[model samples]
Each structure stands twice: as structure tokens, then as C-alpha cells.
Target: MRVTWRDHSPHSEAFDDIYFNPLHGKEESLYVFWQGNLLNEKLAGNVQTVFTIAETGFGTGLNFLCTAQSFIGQSKEAQCLHFISVEKYPLALTDLAKSHTCWPEFKSLSDQLIQQYPPSTPGVYTLAFLEGRIKLTLIIGDAASGFSQLSAMVDAWYLDGFAPSKNPEMWSDALFQQMARLSHKGTTFATFTAAGAVRRGLQAVGFEVEKRKGFGQKRERLVGRYLQDNIPEPTVTPWFDLPSQARPEQVVISGAGLAGCTTAWALAQRGIKVTVLDAADKPAQGGSGNPQGALYTKLSVKPTLQSELHLCASHFSLNLLRQLDPEQTFWSECEVVQIATDDAERTRQQALINEAAYPQEIVEDGSKDTLSKLTQQTVTHDGLIMKLAGWVSPADFCRALLNHPCIDYVPDSQLTELTYQDGMWIVQTAAQKTYHTSTVILCQAEATSQFVQTQHLPLKPIRGQVSIIPASVTNQKLNQVICGDGYISPPFRDHYCFGATFELKSTSLEITDSGHDTNLHNLAKVLPDLAADFEKSKHLLTGRVSFRCSTPDYLPIVGPAPDPETTLERFAPLRKDRKWKFSNVSASHLPGLYVNCGHGSKGLVTTPLCGEYLAALICAEPLPMRKPIHDALNPSRFLIKNLIRKQI
Candidate 1:
């Protein structure tokens, strides 16, 4: 999206300002939005909890910055702010930064926003400012669709779209209805446009509209309050609506792998004490035990639930890793080469490069020459290079997360049965150990479904073997993680972690010669010199094997666990008729049971975001992501989809 600059005013090249004036942009925003919405009063009144504000357009982000400045000035130190904005045409970072230069007072804030502004992917992107007290969720899509998928009850709204005459699509009745759906009884809205259509649309949606003196040269603007007789409820699909529970002070999480440790850490941040139970003697003794695993995200050319989640997780986890390993100990920030091994892979790579429009610092296309230079070896095919991707010792990553004082790690305590009675969960382990808590989170991968209550979940166990090949003269030259049919990590210490052959329906951890041979062959296809050296010294080869838990769909399951018997009976109408429609129904969840499992291969990238989301749900805080994302990862998605399709 390009902005044409004329007479020191930024105008959208596409919509031609749509009867909206950008002249005196900052001053106009302060008066029309800040003053019109009465934000000072709202923030002061809602001092104990989060104050949420929403906007129709995020053009240049002037409204957001001005509101942030006002919030910091008027609110107490403990107060939090959440700003949700929707934009169809997101300007490039360079354009946004250039436009923000008009206001010197916002330079510092503008710079930080530009730095964290996400790529032009059509999904929700979250950014934090003011040390996490001020959060912004940017929905890069049309106002109607974005608001439909949003999951927040707003206190104020800055209806900052173009003039109704210029861009009627944004001011349509559908958008107003969505606004009403996302508002409370007392929600207030302010807009520069005083169009009769806008006023009628708001009134139709139960808002009491009023004309106000306009800012600058304009004669009048509009401000209104939602005066609906009843509070608006979440307009989510019946199958996807999840009722949050009253938060518990203590929780017991099963599994001590990446998923478990990350979930524990997130809960600890919210002052929740946790007891982690693992079957193994220590953490990271399963799939997370990989000595060196690549931190690569699974991307798709077309935006899907999995792709969007992966993108969000990739950005978040990379930033988190940098913070945890400031010294880069056990964590390497190196480029990852995802080579195009065949026609399908080449097409996928090209589509990702052309369609994703990722920032150069995140991902970009790498020609054969560039790939050769980055890997210090010859490559025949062009590939996508994740510039921020790297490798980490999973064990180290888990340890860093579990070091929190609020988390208690109980090892070699395999949970055999889960029973809920009298509002408390009893976790019985195989070693005759019993632990009790008001809340329980299952993060034990495939074993998450082992409990009688969760046996209906469709989780698969995949066996994988990784061969450790000693670093040779040529292997030592490798500079980063490389992948084609398989992945090869940069030399960790004395060896390069190469491998992994995936075997389905297998849980055996036995290291077989054929697995090692398969890995050698995979390596040979990409780096013949390194393979030859490994074959020459085959006796020195060693390996580790582990099992990964996966769902039928690759996306992980992260939310409250569903009560099988109750859910099936409640939604049984779909068993006879697939087209059956239900209204205002929520998932039948077992009171305090949650699960975060089935990440499979992208665990390193996806687990951290899942952790944050799970924590928010448990603590009854505003969700970190949008509703569509939550629906995609809901643990009951499989069951609900099957019922909807009449597959049960």
C-alpha cells in the first residue's frame, strides 16, 4: 500500500482519503478520538483491570500512539491497556516510519512500534509496549471480517475509517453489527464522520448516537454510547465458544518437555504455583530430548490456521530465545536453508517467497550461489532462507524455563489415572504417588490421551531417530542448519546432529542400523563430501531415538480439555443430522482440565505461543491472540468437526 504525500499530508493512494482529511493528523486525532471517546474517564474508572479500545482503521497509527501517550499520563502504574485495530491496506514499515516523523513528540514511541510491526500477513499480530503494560493487537484485514473474529469486549472505539461517502464498504451495517457484538452496554464510540448513514447504522445496532462539535475546520463529528438493553455475548460459533473458569492458585501439569516447561513458566508469570509430573527421570527425555533441533517454522503459501499460528509462534519464540540466551550459550542465531529438493518443494518455496512478503530479516529467497555461501558448501537448488532461524539444545531450553521458583518439578512420576471429585483433581501415578490440585494441565504428548477422560482424542505417536556424525574437515565448514529431505545442524561441539527418519505408529526408541543408513543417505543427497567422511568412519556413528505426538491435523491442540461423554451427549443433534444448528452453546469442558499437546515437529516454534495462550485462558485474562486462532487450536476441534460432518 502506497501513501501519496501532498502538501505535507499523507493520503491513501488507493481510496483518495474517502472524504477524510489527514491535514493536522495528530491534532485531529487527539481531539476527535481522545476527547470524543472520553478515554481519560474510562481509563480512570477501569483502573483495576485492563481497559480495551478498538479502532476501525490503523492508518499511520497516529490514533494508537496518541491514546498510548494519554493512557500512560492518566492511568496508574498497575493499569493495562489493550488496543485492537483493523486495517485492510497495511503500509510498509518504511512508509509508516516516514509518516510518523511528522510528530516529533512520538518519535521514540513510533520507532519502537516500527521495529515490532509485523509483516503483511493477513492475521492478528500482537505487539507489546511500555514494558508489556500496553498491548496492541493489529488485525490485518477488512473491518467486518476482523471484528467478527476478534475476542474482546471494548470500552471505547475510535471509528477512524475513511468517510462513508468515499469508503462505504467500511461503514456498512455489517461492521456496525459486529461492533455491537463486541461491545458492552456502556461502550462509547467517536468518529470524525457525521454522515446520516453512519448515525442510523449505529442506532440500528443499539447505540445512542449524538452529533458533536468537530475538530479543526470540520463542522461536526459523531459520538455515541452503546445503550443496548442487555450486555452483548460472544458471537462465536457454538462449537468454538469456551467459557473461562475462575482462576486457580495452584496447578499440576503432566510432562516436563518443551510443552510442559513452557506452560509452567507462563503460569508462573501470572503468580500461579505449579507441580510438573513427568514419567521420565528428568525433563526433555522424550521428543524434547533432541541434542540440537532446528528452530524452523512450517509455512504455507495460502494462509491457513496452521500457517498463521506458526508465523506468530516463530516471531515470538525467536525473540524469547534471544532474551533467555543473551550470551547465545546453547542457542545459535544462524540462517536455516530449506532447500528445494523436488518440483513440489520448489513451487512451495517460490510461492512462500512471492506471497508471504516477509521482511528480509525474517525470511527471503536464497539463490544457489547465496545458499552455497551461507552453508559453506555447494547447493544445486534455490531455497527459502530463514535468516532468524537457528538451532537450540532442547534440554537447555527446557531447563531455562523450569528454573522459575514457583514451579515444582516431580520426575519419574508417571500419571496413570485422572479423577475429579469435589472440585479437585486427583492425579495417580504408576509409582503409587498421588497428587491433588484444583487445576490440571496435560502436556505429556501422546500420553495426554492415556487418561480415560481424554481417550477419545486422535493423537498419533511417531518414532524418529537422529544420527550424530562426527565433524569432519568438510563438515566443520558448515555454518548453519540445512534441510531438504532431512535436516543437518551446524557442528554442535565435536559432531553435527544429522538425521531423523520418521516412522509412523512406532514408539520404539531402539537405534537401528537402517535408521543410521537412511540418515547417511539423506545427508549424502545434500552434502556428498560430508556423507563420504561419515561413511568412512561409520564405526564412530551414534544416535538417539524418541517418539513425537501428533494430531491428525498438524496443528497442535491447546485449550481446555473436553469431557467426552458430556460433549457428545450435548452435541448429539449433529450425530443424526449434520446440518443441525445450535445457538449460544459452549463447549462441555471438564471443569479444570487443560491440555497443550500434539505440536509434532514444530514444537520449538509453536510451544511458546501456546504456553502464553494457555496461561491467559487459565488466568482469565484477555487472550493473547484472536478467537479464530483459539478455535483452530481448541482441543475439541477434532470431535466437534467429526460431529459437524456426521462422521461419528
Candidate 2:
């Protein structure tokens, strides 16, 4: 986005309009958006549990800052402000900082926002503030398409964008329809524009718009409420439909690995009591127990649901790691380099760099020289350099996450049975110890499907082993994590961890000599010069072997678990007619059963976001993901897909 400074105020070059009324911008923001939405009354005391605010434009994020400051002032315990905004042409960091200079009152909050501001990438970024009490989902794309992908129940709207005449796309019928889709009765909206077409469009979509005294010298502005929500929700894909549930008194997580610990952290921060159960003696004893894991994203050449999820997860995970590990002892943003060893891989990397249009702050194409410089070792192939990504001690991260005051970590307890009765879930471990809770989440990797409710999920187990090689004085001190078919981290506790063979056939938990040989081979391939000493002394390598949980589509299975017999019977009509729309049929789910496993190898980067998503869904807050991506990760997707294909 290009912005020009005029009289010390930021002016949008694309829309040819000023960002705000420059005279009293702060007061105008409070007057037109804050007080106009009646937030003073709605957010005072304990009127509601959560109040969501969505905006058409996020110019300088001034409105968000003002709202965040106010929300924290009035919001009490268990009350949250979920702020979402869409921006087609997002300003750069320097530009945003320059625009934010006009408000000295919002310096503290504005600085925090600036510090956490994401790279200029086109995707959804869910950021947390005030200990997750104030959430922000910034959609960096076109307003209408972005909101169309979002599934939220908004309580207020900040219609702040360029004028209707200059930016017609922001004031279209589609946007109005989306507003109606996300709103219900009593939902409020405040806009700086009072154009006749704008008022008519909103009224046509069930909003009651009225003119109010404008800010400053302006004559009038539009303030309204969503009185009648006539907009119809999707009749298709009802199996992926998500309805909110009440806040539970207690939640039980099946595993104490990355997924469970992160999930517990998310819920505990939201004031929910969580109990994490694990089979091992301590947390992160499974695949997440790797000595060091790469924190990076494998972006596709073009954007797909999988790629978008990765982009979103990478951004979220990067921020979370920093927040959880501030000292850089167990986590460090030392950057990561994924080398393309062969000609075909080089071509693919080149195409990704040329076609993907990703922000340089997130990823950049590495020529052979760039790769060598980043790794501080000699390399001959092209690669991708993840700037903000790094290496993390997964075990340490998980252990620290489960140390929350609201979390109870019970080791040596393997969840064996789950049954929901009388609005409560009875959870039993291997020793017949039973605990009752209102909700149960399965995060136990491959063991997640051991329960009857989740047995239908097509979870696959892939064996992975990471070899630990002692770093010698003669070996080069690798600064960044390097990846090819296998990955090697920088030194951790005087040992370099590498390899990790992804075997689909082997389910062996015991480490084998072949695993070490495979690690040596991959190490030789990815970094021949660095592996010279290790290859000669390969016998000194020892590793840890564990099975990783994956799905047929490779996406994590999240969201509520479908009732086995009921879903089979209800969706059986699809077998006769693939396009069958059971308009009268509603999907059935196991009351409070949810799944959060199947992270596979990207567990370090993906688990945190999925945890936040599930927590938001369970807590009845605005979701942390787009609707399509959420559906793609739905636990019932395989069932519905197979029912239509007549394979079930």
C-alpha cells in the first residue's frame, strides 16, 4: 500500500483520500466508532461474556488500539473483546508507525500493536493481547472476500474505509450481505459515511440504518443496528457447520504433548480449568519429544487451503514461541534454511519464489550463495530462507506450557474410554481412574482414535527418528537449522540433532541401526561438508523413535467429533445421490467430544494455532481461522467425503 504524507497526516495514494479527519482524529475515532456502536453500555461491567468488533478497514489500526484500550478498562474477568478487521492494502510497518505518531495517548497500546504487527502477507493473522482477553484477527486481503471466508458472530462493526465514491468495492452489496450473515438482532454498526446507496444497501440486507451527528464539522454519519437477519446460512456443507457450546467448568485433554499442552495453555489463559493426561512419566514423551525441531513453513508454489493454513500457522506459531520463551533458552529465532538438493527441487523452489508473491519478511528465495551464507556452510543448490523462523526444543516448550496455574498435568495416565452422559463426559484412564468433565479433547496423536467417538477418523501412523550426533571441535558450528529430506538443528546441549526418517511402513518404537544409517545418509546429502566427520563416526549416533499421527489429506483433524451411528445414518443419503442436500437433516455430534491431533511433522508450528482455534470454538469466541480452512480441518470431513463417494 502506498501512502503519502500530507500536512503530517497519512493520505492513501490508492484511494486519494485522507485516512481520517486530521483535525481531531483521536476524538473522531472515539466519537464515530466507539461511542457510536454503544460499546460504553454493552461492555460496561459484566453485561456480556464476549463482545466482538469487526471493521471494514484497518487504516493505521488506530480504531483497534482505541477499542483495545477501552475494552481492557471495562472488561472484567471472563469477558473478552475479539476484534477483527480487513484491509486490502495494508500499510508497511514504517508507514503504520508514521501514521500512529499522531496519537500520543495510545502510545503504549500502539507500540504493542506495532511490535506484534505481522509481515505484509495476504492471509489471516490472529494476534492476542492482554493475555488473550483481547483477540485480533487481521485479514490482509480484499474486504468482502476476506469476510466471506470468515465465520464469526460480530457484535459491532466499524465501517471505516475510504469514501464510498472513491472505494466502491468496500461499499458493495456483497459486503452488506456478509455483514448480515455475521450479525444478529441488536448487533450495532457505526460508519463515517451516510451515503444514500450505503444506507439503502445495508437496509436491504436487514440492518436498520439512521443518520447521527457526524464527528467534528461533518453534518451526519450512519449508525445502525442489525435488526432483522434475513440472510440465509449455507444449506450445503452442514456437516462442517459449527455451533457454539457453553463454557465448561472443566476440560480434559487426552495427551500432554505439544497439542495438549498448547491447547491447555490456550484454554487456561481464557480462564478455563484444564486437565492434561498423558501415558508417559512427563510431558512431550512422544514425537514432540524431539531434542530440537525446526520452526518453519513449507509454502506451496500457489495458495491452497493447505498452504494458507501453513502460512497462518507459521505466523501464529512464531509469535507464540516468542511469547512463551522470552529468554531464548529453549526457543530461538536463529532462522532456518531448507535446501533444494536436486535440479527438479531447485526448479520448484525457483517457481515458488517467482510465483508465490510472499512477503520477504516471511520467506525469500535463496540462491546457492544466499543458502551458503545463511547456513554458514558450503552448499550448491537453491533453497528457501525463512527469516523469522527458527529452532525450538519441543519437549521444553510443552513442559513449560503445561505449567499454567489453571492446568493440571497428570502423568502415567493413558485415556482409554470416553462416554458422554447427562451433559457430562466421563473420562477413564488405563488404571480405571475416572474423571468427569463437561468437555473432552483428544490430543493423543495416533492414540486419539482409540476412543469410540473418534474411531472413524482415518488417522495414519508414520514412524520418525531423530539422531543425536555429538558436535566436535573440528566440525563447523552451524548457526541455523538446515532441512532437506531430513533436518539438522544447531547444537543443543553440545549435541547436534539431525535426521528423522519419515517411514510409512515401520511402526517400530525402538531405535534401529537403519534409522541411524538413514540419518547419516540424509545428513550427507543435505550437508556433505558438515557431515564429513559424522559420516566417518556414524556409529556414535543415537536417536529417539516415535510415531507421528497424520491423515490421508495430511491436514490436522480438529473440531467436534461426529456421532458414529447417527452421522452414518444421516449422511447415508449421499451414497444414493452425491449431490444430495438433506435440507431437513441436521448433523449429530458427540455432545462435547473434540479432536486436536494429527499434526504430523509440523506439530511445532501448527499445534499452537489449532489449540487456539479449538479454544475459541469451545469458548464461543470468534474463530481464529477462515471458514473454508476450518471446514477442511473438520473431523467429519473424511466421513462426509466417503459417504458421497460410497466408500463407507
Candidate 3:
């Protein structure tokens, strides 16, 4: 994670290039990359559409900064710019901040980039600037893996890898093939190297190559354009490739909870009008009605579908929550302490710290004494501290999301049935009133299973109850949220919220005295010191109960709603072979119908990103996360797995 700085230049001890031209890095970038790739012309050509630029290397981000400056200076025809770059080994934030100071002209932009630079986790990190007109997607991994996972149609390429002699792996034939896969017929690329291997590799991938005058001391550079007369189409696994309908002008979202409201805001940002319907009398009157909810990434030692999605969601959640609640009234990044109650948990926490390579600012190892000092409370065991994890008022956040001008939140409008006809979905309410739209997203939690079409989806309702404890003046020093078997929040407005008991196979919303006792028991197990104070005031405990829609594996079900009968018939061959091959099996969706539910206990951290994913699917934008994460959240995944095992 450290960048070795030599002579004020960031030298990659693992690769080549001083990251920039030491003599004049800014000028070299503007000339060789900006002018060489004709970014100004390409950006200006797309009057209203997004002009995408892909880079093989994004060392100190000099190329991106210069390109952003160029885009801002371009003619009025240009609207937006998307820069996607891959870096195998990322420079730490401190090093990035130091290297960026060399370019005083880019001071403002550099400061913003440094402020939002993500942790050293190897996944895609998205950042926006210039009022969302210019976007950057930083892929922190090897070139081929990053490019293969990228989900965008690129318009230009910044082949700024280290010299072909130093980092040939980045300029390999496989990399060129992936580039070709993401490019269109007119996609152009430029690089500082003119090696034969580079030229042949690009040409073999269908690009017409040429030699050009290089900038600075270099004599020549390689430039090329994708010119195959018959451009190949970008393809995914046929089963997962859902055909996208035209972006709807008006969308109807069921359930005005966290998922629905957030999705509404995301679509509204793209100028789409949204109508949010809820069965309750008000927004967040369901599972999201909680007084406070915690936010943190559910990570494991090794990357799995759930872990990857959790990591991706955690990053997206922080960036988005900050944007929406700039005043920090609805949520607070007050940090969280996850107490390790047993040796198993302590070892798991240690493995997470040592294996993930996460930035300390995001998550770090902590001792019992360190946590005690942080919370100003005595701790019996060590724990993992996530600096960014905290709590949010879900109801207030939902209200804020629905406050957008483009979103119309209708309360007490329960959707009883859905019928698709004439290329539009008709949503009928219990009152016999009907609403029609080209798109409908069901965010109605486990109640979504009541519909015959979605009955097969593996969704269950788990009842959860949280007991509220009045914080005494003596406990005012408890300044951080603490968690173990259950969680306890720091004093918030004369009281602390804690002790949530998860009850599976229960739909009852009645808060019981026994539930509060169970919570007290959990608190005693996690924090005995706090439990002693709570026990003396047990008579005053009050609580609330709600039901959360959960999946067996705990991952949320997002994306388009599949047609049950058709899907089973289409994938029937899976009964014989787990890896059944099918051609052109476009996703059999209940057209214009989608669902975002079953987020379970992680809705606060997961739903915001799930909202963005649903919005991207509807708007046909580049997905916020990679394809594998999408597959994990696919509503059809359970059915596919069962079919493969011949269980249905």
C-alpha cells in the first residue's frame, strides 16, 4: 500500500514509470494522452451521451486529472465524461496526496480525488465530480482481470501502461482482446510505447495500428482505432443477459421504505419521474421504521459472492449516504466497535485484518483497552473497529430520499395485484384503484412472495425486536456503538438503543417483555459493565418490533423479476448437467417488472447500493459493481441453483 517516493517522484518498485514525467509530468500527460488520444474531439463528438475513457494504468491519476480539465474546457457540445482506469497496486492516500501537490494547476481537483480515494481493496470504486458531469471508476487490480470485469461500452482508451519492457503483462494480447471486447468500431487508443508486440497484439484484436510522434524525449508512440467492419457485440452468459426495455419516463415503485425511496432518488437524478407506493400510512412504516440502524461491511477471510457484494455495498453506502445527508442529521459516521466475545470471533477478526489489506480508516485491529478508551467504557475483550461504520435513522433517511422533486411518494396505497398488458404493467390496489407504468419495482419486503409469480423466490420473514434503554448521566461517556451477540448504541438524546433479538419463522410485530429480557441477556454476554447499569433500570425498558425479509444465504434479491414457469422450462436441461449449455437464452423476465427485497439485517448498508443497481438496470448505465456480484443478487439465482441440483 506504500508508494516509494524518490526525488519527489512516485517510483513503482514493482513496475516501471516514475508515475509521471519527472521533468514535466502534467505537460507530458496533456500532450501524449489528452491530445494524442484526441479526447477533446471525442468528448465533443458526443453531444448528450457519456464519453467513456479507459486507461490501462492510473498511477498518480495525472492522465485522469488532465482529461477532466480537457473535458471541462471542451465546447458546449460535451455533456459528461466517464474515466475507467485499472491499477494493479494502488498508491496509498497519503502518497497520492503528496504526489498530486506537484501539479498546482490541478490543486482543487487533486484535493477532491485524494479526499474520496478508496481503501486499498481490489475492487471497482466509483467517484463523481463537477456536479456528476464527470465520473471516475477506479478498478484496483491487474489489467486483464479488471478489464474483463468492467461493464461499460468504452469510447476511447488511454493505454498508459509502464514501458513494454518493464510491464509487458499489462500490455499483453489478453488485455488487448478484452479492450476489443469493450470497444465499438470507432474506439481509438494511444500509448507511449510503439513496440512490435504492442502493435501486433492490438492488430490481432481487430484494431488498425499506427506509429505517432511521442511526447517529451520519446521518439515514437503507438496509436490505433478499432476498425473491424463487423463489430462484435458485447455478450454475457445468455441466461443472465436480460433484455433492457427503453428507459421509462415514469416508474412505479412498491413500498416506500429504504429500498424504494433510494431507488426513486437514483432514477430521479437521471430525470426519471417516480411514484412510490406503500401499504402503510407513511414511508418507512415497515422494516425501515427502525429508530436507528447500523452500517458496516459483512466481510470474510476469503472473497465469496456474499463477501464481495458486501464489500462493494459498504463502499457505495458511505459515499452515497454522505452525499444525501451532507448535514449528517439522518446518519452519523461515529465509528463502530464489534466486540469479539469468544476466541473464535477474536481469530476471525484477526484474519480479516491480516488478510483483507483494508485501510485502517475503514477497518483495523483493536484491543480491548483501545476500544475501552474509544467508548469511554470498560471492555472485557478485544474487537474490530470500523471507523466509517455507524448508525442512521432509517425513517428520516427515507423521508429525505423521497423529498426529491421527481419522486411522488403516495402513502396507504397498497398494491394487491400486478397485471402486465400492452407493454405496460398495471398495478391494482386493494381499493380497486389502478396505476400503470412501463416499469415497476417491488420493494415490499417478504410480502412480495404473496404474488403467485414471485412465490418461488426463497424469501422468509424474520421478526426482530430492539429494546430501548434510558442512558443515565453517569453513562454519558459511552461514545461509540458496540456490538457482539447483539448491539448497543451510544447515548443518543438521553437514551441508548440496544439488544435486537432475531426471531426466525415469526411475523408477529408484538414487542414482548421476554424479548427485552433476551436482549438484556445478550448485553450481559457482550458488555457486562453496561449490563449492570441496565439491569438496575430494567423496569423502564421499552422496545419496538418489525419483520425483515431474509434469504437463506442472507444476500439480497435484486434485479429483474423472472418469469417462473418459463424460466423452469427454459433451464430444464440443468436437471441433467449442473453446467447445462444454452444458446441465446435471453433472460425471461416479467417485462417491466423488477424486485429489490430480502436485504435482511444489512439493509442499511446493502439497500442503497441495491437501489443504484436497480436504477442502472433500468437506465442502461454502467453497473456500479462487477458482474459476479450482480449474479449473486439475481432473483433467479436460487431457481438456477435448485435446477442444477435437480431439486425441483
Compare the candidates by TM-score and give the number of the best one. Answer: 2
Q: Backbone clashes in each candidate structure, one number apiece?
A: 0, 0, 0
Sort order, TM-score high to low: 2, 3, 1
lDDT of each candidate versus the true structure:
0.83, 0.86, 0.82
Worst 10 residues of 2 by lDDT: 229-238
Q: Using lDDT as the measure, what is the rank order of every candidate, best first?
A: 2, 1, 3
TM-score versus the correct structure, for each prediction: 0.90, 0.97, 0.95
Query: After best superposition, candidate 3 residue 27: deviation in angstroms?
Result: 2.7
lDDT of 3 by residue, 1-648 (tens): 455778898888776457888878878888777877787776656654567889999889999999888788884533677789988888887788888888889887887788678777777777777755678888888999888876777778999867889987788888998999888888889888889999999999899998988886789988879996444453445556655778789999999988888888888877789999898888898888878888876567676767666766777777777777878877777778889889999998889887866668678788989887887777889988877577888899899889898998888899999888898888998868799899999998988878877888888888899988777724546667788888887666677788688898666788899899889888877678788888888888888998888897788989898898888898898899866567666668889889999998888888988898788778766777887788778898888889877889
Error of 2 at 620 (Å): 1.1
Clashing pairs in 3: none
Decide which is better by TM-score, 1 or 3: 3
Q: Once superposed on the true structure, which residue ranges of model 1 sit more than 4 Å away at CA?
A: 6-9, 18-27, 102-108, 229-237, 326-328, 347-366, 405-413, 428-436, 470-476, 583-586, 624-626, 641-648
Top candidate by lDDT: 2
Deviation from native of the Cα of residue 56 in model 3, angstroms: 1.2
Provide the lowest-lDDT 10-residue window in model 1: 229-238
Model 2, 1-648: lDDT tens digits are: 898999988898889999877788878898999999988788764366778899999988989988988877866766888899999898999989988888888898787688778777778899888777788899988999998988788999999989999999789999998899989888999998899999999999888899998877789999999988445565687787775688887899999989999999999998789999999999998889989999888888887888788878887987787777778889778778888978888788888888967878878888888788777788877888887688899999998898799999999998888887888999899977999998999998888887777888888889999888788733587898898989998898889899889999987788899888888888777788877888777777888988889999999998998887888898898889978876867778888888998999999888999999999899887888888898999998889889878888
Candidate 2 positional error at 596, Å: 0.9
